[model samples]
Target chain A: MTDLSQQLAFVLEIDKLKAVYRQTTVKEDKDRHENSAEHSWHIALTAQILKDYAEYPIDIERVVQMLLIHDIIEIDAGDLFAFAEQQDHAQQALKEAQAAERLFGLLPPQQHEQYKALWFEFEAAESNDARFAKAMDRILPLVQNMNNNGGSWAKHKISQPQVLARNKHLEYIAPKLWQYVVQQTDLAVSNGWLKKD
Target chain B: MTDLSQQLAFVLEIDKLKAVYRQTTVKEDKDRHENSAEHSWHIALTAQILKDYAEYPIDIERVVQMLLIHDIIEIDAGDLFAFAEQQDHAQQALKEAQAAERLFGLLPPQQHEQYKALWFEFEAAESNDARFAKAMDRILPLVQNMNNNGGSWAKHKISQPQVLARNKHLEYIAPKLWQYVVQQTDLAVSNGWLKKD
Candidate 1:
């Protein structure tokens, strides 16, 4: 296939991301789960809206790209609940790296490298943009839980400490969003929607 | 509300876009229509993938941002099918502008101005970035149709002339993508998936 064909193929392949559902419920409809594609969109938009609060000044464009493609691997690896115990970090990373190679490799050579690098940067979560992007990713589900009477938290019986631990990066990377998360989690506990322990 | 609260409110409200279904079906599942949110995600990715084909050099960050938030008005005004006859574009514009205000207005003032301006620029489609963004928007549905064996075209009995006419902007703004569309449409017609004009 030619370069355009390769790019178009990648586009079509990534459409499967729309069907890969996460544990978080859509705010409008509690019965339904949020798919990775829309979740990616929400976080990309969040990166722009909340960039002002990032502890490190970020290149917003890179952050948006990182957020956009960050979840494409979910199409293959499937979403592992952030709070799930007995998690296999090593296995998850291996699966996602393979998935990333296959998906991003569908693009032309240059774009494949460009997008693959962004995905890796996002996975590393160390750069200014990556750190900020990860914070938004963690915070969206936290807010979604608050929106739906502690959505996934109540469903999974998640505690405030667990939530905070999963999102600890936000403390140093996005102080304002971290504060918002703390306030929301406290409210969740007070409302009896989250575990107090 | 503080800026953070206002921004969070906007985020929650825009979640409604995930429920606003477009005519195009997810390529993976024929029964399910593509929602505005995932469609926005796809086009944003397309803007990055196809940026090199633009008639003019575009600040892709602006193009991607424009695409991400463009269909958000569909949350209130709802999607308008491109090939539908008797489209009251003036009325459509009125509804979308109102929706834009109510939705983007949920953001803090500065961010509101920034996003709303991007939305309006996409609608105008006059600038280099806006023109290229518009081209990507038009091509996505067309490709979706071709991918699913004239998915929407056969469903609506749309003709080649109609498809070309609807996506005429691509001819000038993204000539390479326009060429790809022509080739795909010809293939669709040959396969008896699209009506020949």
Candidate 2:
């Protein structure tokens, strides 16, 4: 087989990995249930949109790379409900790191290092790209939850303070995006989508 | 809640989407059965590693962006098996585009536009960045399949000619990566992982 064809075959095989999640809406509208692929795509786009708002003169490309792979570890760790017991966070992170190693290793060696680095950067959230990527990563779901009438939070019995406490970093990372999220949260509370707590 | 915290929450929500197809393995090897998020990460890294090898002077940022969001549509369209019936390709693309519209739209308006543009460019495959991104997209899986001993090709009953016809564009897109893919395919066939056909 020719080289290109081999690549195509590889691409075709990657598609099978899409069935890991079902993206259900706990208490939100039908539109709120996005698949894993959709979520990553949206966040990567979020990175592009918010690149300019970064506190530093960020590398948009690096931010995009971070966003694209940031959550891939979730595949193996399973989506650790953010509001779940905080103790699980460490274990989840460990599982995700292992997943990252296996998944990113799919590329040729040179490419593998590049991705593994970006994934690490995002996880570390120390670099400007990682910070910005982390910020966008936090912002997308607030919009989804608000738009969907607090779907997951309501279903999970998540409270306003819990939501606020979990997501306060947005203000420092991207103020504008954060401001928007706060407004949505208030609206959700007033609308009774979430408890005042 | 602080905006930052809210934004972080958003990112966590997006992570849930990958649960749809995270651990799936097609006819490919365990490593090749990477999730969509991992796939995006790998391609972006591939773009970075192979950036120097491009025949033309390309915008690395644009290429990275393209790689990051290229397969997101697969979330909605579901992945099409490469060797599956021919009629599904167009249908899958259409579904993926629609999915892109909704998913990318989740970002703030400005971000929505920026991300949509990157996704569109990758889909168009007309620009230099797009070409390089496309090449990386093809190359990653080629490596994985070859390393795994023709993991998917043999199971799917793929022919050498069919593989070549589908992937020849890699030659023009990124010659070095294409060369590597060709070498790997030869090795796989020689190892009896793939039939001579």
Which candidate has the highest DockQ of all?
A: 1
Can you write out model 1's per-residue Cα lDDT over A29-132, one digit (the tens) per residue?
54599899999999999888888887777999999999889999988898887876555767888999999999999998999898999999989988888888
Worst 10 residues of 1 chain B by lDDT: B82-91
* Residue-level lDDT tens digits of model 2 in B1-197: 54344334434444533433532243423343555654675567456555777888899887877776676666567667666676887787788789888766665565557777888888787887787787777666566666456767777767665665556667886677667666766776778766667
TM-score of chain A of each: 0.95, 0.84
Candidate 1 chain A, poorest ten consecutive residues by summed lDDT: A81-90
- Candidate 1 total steric clashes: 0
How good is model 2 by TM-score?
0.65
Q: What share of the true interface contacts does candidate 1 keep?
A: 0.58
lDDT of 2 by residue, A36-120 (tens): 5446666775576456666557878777767656666665666767676877887888888898787666655655677788888
